[model samples]
Target: MRYCIERLDGQHCLFVDGRKELLIYLKQASSETITDIRKVYRNGVSDSVLEIYLPYRKQ
Candidate 1:
């Protein structure tokens, strides 16, 4: 799957699979500030998909 970044709000951003609105949001950030952030693991549909983790998110 292809991944991309999007601005969800004034202070929030998202990194998601291209073409889908299902995304991950980050507070106090924007698309322009994306470079300042670090990306690690991601959760996706399969083992080969990016293993992104929503650590700060409340389960």
Candidate 2:
């Protein structure tokens, strides 16, 4: 599975492919600002496992 980070309406968002529990856990555990988590489905398949809204982080 892969993940992508994007910006929508000025809010940072995350999208990750489904079926990977460890990946989800790792992301959540490593990030403190992640919130509004939800799943997305397409054609009844869980194509996107996580849609997390977070504040922008400065690197």
Candidate 3:
């Protein structure tokens, strides 16, 4: 399985895999949310890669 993550805003995130969709709610996420994301591949013999984008890190 492969996917891509995009930060919708400061309180929401979206994970997209090809045509599949997985919405991640971060309303209660803390500062550590940036590193609390996980992606796993379960399908075999597939040409896909998981792409994850963490929330904007405050500098």
List runs of model 1 lying over 4 Å from the truth.
1-9, 21-59
Cα error of candidate 1 at position 40, Å: 18
Q: List the residue pairs that clash in candidate 3.
A: none
lDDT of 1 by residue, 1-59 (tens): 44443233326534554423224443333334442222324563323222352332223
| Model 2: lDDT of residue 47 | 37
Lowest-lDDT window of 10 residues in candidate 2? 50-59
Cα lDDT, all candidates: 0.36, 0.44, 0.38
- Model 1 TM-score is 0.19
The TM-score leader among the candidates is: 2
Query: What is every candidate's alpha-carbon RMSD to the true fold?
Result: 11.3, 7.5, 9.0
1 or 3, greater by lDDT: 3
lDDT accuracy of residue 56 in candidate 3: 30
Local distance difference test, candidate 3: 0.38
Best by lDDT: 2
Better of 1 and 2 by TM-score: 2
Q: How close is candidate 3 to the true structure, as a TM-score?
A: 0.25
